[model samples]
Target: MTSVQDFATYIAGLPRVLASAAALFRDVEGRVLLVEPNYRDGWALPGGTVESDTGETPRQGARRETAEEIGLDRTLGRLLAVDWIPGTGRPPLVAYLYDGGVLDPGDLAAIRLQETELLSWRLVPREEITDHLPGALGRRVLAALDILTQDTGTAELENGHRVG
Candidate 1:
């Protein structure tokens, strides 16, 4: 019979995907809200890694991250997009984007960036999304924008590219 340690090791060896969640908040003028991370060169949506270990759902995680990062407590809407990013000598990741709803002048004044993790927050026009976000993130955001416009369904992407 297999030893207890061996069984545990077998379970541990199974593949796992790191999951992350983010929110897409828009301004009155339809610009997307992007936060500049202190640890990264480009800007990103207002969200963070999902606490799957805590049994948190993607929608809940998105709300939590938005509250933590921007100090804005708001209810998250539907799932905007889901992307499975390929590994680059590292474990692959599954990212979720949720609709955070539009922010008016009052909401805009209430934003308080998480000082430690974020450098600053700004509203970027949709056309300049590529300039703010790098690589897959730019594509992911664009896909999300399209979904919002369609009001149809969620987008499934692989490394930010739409997949069947």
Candidate 2:
């Protein structure tokens, strides 16, 4: 274990959790933007798994996922929320949510959905977010929005429930 190679192997063998990052985009009217993924049942924010193996941070992963899923490459805003979700039959997951800011009409018009992954995109008001996102995911998005509406700092969550 004293050798560098031994340390490397030890680190590689350690248990790891899955991580994902997403952007909370909003329209000028304050409607949250959601995307329908072809590979999933419910709608979701524009984001995906962080490429930790490639040295991609959660923030970078959010921006990348936004660009890849919706074709918007703008810089993301401050982190809104972080949620740790317990896995059902797999590794636990750490989900990062970032502020995508309010999109202008032109920005909205410029959206280009990634056909291979996304089915479509739409703007949903806060009240209807649950209808689209559902479950812990919906609650997570709501917590992020609360941070924006209240001007509070970032939120820490466990399974979408605010912890501290």
Candidate 3:
């Protein structure tokens, strides 16, 4: 499993263009899975940039992230949304947010944390996501979740929101 820092270093060393997948996992109980960063102390949806080794599709990247980060076999749903993180000393990130459903809840409970990146994991209720997440990523994830649940074509976020 690749650590987020290692992944960032790898991305930093590459060319300016980058592609990533943000996989949103939801359970029947209506709780979403979120990972807490070790260094930043904030919650984020579990997923990562697409790697060359895994091929070019965002769906493939989402599947890989699920196995690597959360230890689950998930069925990839529609491409719910896309957002771009403007360049800030590093390459601009084009993140593809996908709606993903897990095959088993027990597998989620059995997740093995990659300590270098994630400090811990939690199943957070929709109403309480804002309290747990730190910043913009929270808003984006929640918006994506709303769009996914409603089967809507667009997600609405506040300032700095990006959807494609």
Candidate 4:
């Protein structure tokens, strides 16, 4: 497993912000996958910073992150959107969003979360997501879901402002 110190070093070596992939998985019932952070109180999508030495494509990174975080091996879907999360002390993060589909229903029942970073995992509706997730992350999750589900007429940000 990669440590935060190692990740920070990797980020420091990069010329620009590090690119990452987040897998958005939805069940037939329209419940999306969310993970609660053990270190933090809010929920977030199952993902991680893209490793420089992994030799995996962004889609592969998304698959690996989903399995590691939520124990799922699913078919990856469209390259939804890329987001630039402002950096604090470290470099900013360039996150690639991908649409992922659940391969097996049984995997959902047998989820074994990696406890170091995650506290628990769930498949909940968009309406309930706001309750479990923090403000900005929750909005991003819902926006990504809307883009994937085609629920919103426009795939762009709801407020008509560009996402940096």
Candidate 5:
């Protein structure tokens, strides 16, 4: 019989791609929420990599990342988009974008950026998202916003574009 330790060892040695989740929050006037990460020159949506083998779903990871990065405890409304993107030297990744809902003045004021990994946070107008986020991510945000507006269900994408 295979021992439990052998099974655990086999699983740990298996290669897997990284999975990340982000919350797409907007303001009352229809701007996207972007956070300035300390490690990157450009801004990105509030999110992080999912903890593997932790029994945590993508939705849970999205909510947790939003709270951790922006100090907001609001509920993530829906699954706006899902993207499968490849990486340079690392494994490919699956990214989830959740609807973080429109924020009011009070909600905006309550945002507190995580000082360690995040330098600051701001609301960028829908048209100006490209100025902040990088290429694919900027496109991803724009596509997500489009999906959000039509009141349609969700968008399935590969590298931020519609797959089918």
Candidate 6:
């Protein structure tokens, strides 16, 4: 039989993956909102890593990150996509994408970028999303947009390719 200490040790030693949640905001023109992080090469949705250490769930994390990154505290819509990305150097990543709903001109005017982490934000047309986001992330955003357009259920993805 395993001792209590042994069980704790085993749990602590288990491999862990990183998780993040993002909000997908769109303008009335149907363009997607993207932010350019000061520390990254490409633009990203308004969200960040889930504070799992602090016991924050994915939806909560998405809301918090959206408010922090863009100063938009509106209610988020349904889950759009979830992608499991295989690890390259760091641990694997599970990304949750939530709908941020459409923003009117007033809401768009009210956006305040968290300048410390973001350089700028823009609304990219569907065909131009890949130009801003690139790679797997671009694919994920496109898939999420497709889901919204088709009124389909949530998307499950591996490396940003829709699986089921």
Per-residue alpha-carbon lDDT of model 5 for 1-164, expressed as tens digits?
99999999999999878999999988999998889999968889998888767987888898888899889977788898889898889989999999999999999899988899998888899878988886778888988999988888788888888887
List where candidate 4 sits over 4 angstroms from the true fold.
Answer: 1-15, 102-105, 151-164
Show model 3 residue runs off by greater than 4 Å. 1-15, 102-105, 154-164
- lDDT per residue (tens digit) for residues 37-90 in model 3: 787767788888799554658788888887787666577787876766666687
Candidate of highest lDDT: 6
Model 6 spans with C-alpha error above 4 angstroms: none
Task: List TM-scores for all candidates, in order.
Answer: 0.93, 0.96, 0.74, 0.74, 0.91, 0.97
lDDT tens digits, residue span 1-164, model 4: 99999999998887776768888777778788888879876777888777757687777888888888877767777776666667678777766777876535776787779888898877888799879765555666777777766743323332222454
Task: Report residue 51 deviation for candidate 1 (angstroms).
Answer: 1.3
Q: How many residue pairs clash in each candidate?
A: 0, 0, 0, 0, 0, 0
Clashing pairs in 5: none
Candidate 5 weakest ten by summed lDDT: 131-140
lDDT of 2 by residue, 51-107 (tens): 999999999999999999999998999999999999999999999999999999999
Model-by-model lDDT, in order? 0.92, 0.94, 0.75, 0.73, 0.88, 0.95
How many steric clashes does model 5 contain? 0
Superposed by TM-score, candidate 3 places the C-alpha of residue 2 at a distance from the truth, in angstroms, of 39
Best by TM-score: 6
Q: Is candidate 2 or candidate 4 better by TM-score?
A: 2
Give per-residue CA lDDT, model 6, range 50-133, as digits (tens).
Answer: 999999999999999999999999789999999999999999999999999999999999999999999999999999998888
Task: Please list the residue runs of candidate 2 whose C-alpha ends up more than 4 Å from where it truly belongs after superposition.
Answer: none
Native-referenced Cα lDDT, model 3: 0.75
RMSD for each of the candidates: 1.8, 1.2, 8.2, 7.3, 1.8, 1.0
**Per-residue error (Å), model 3, residue 85:** 1.7
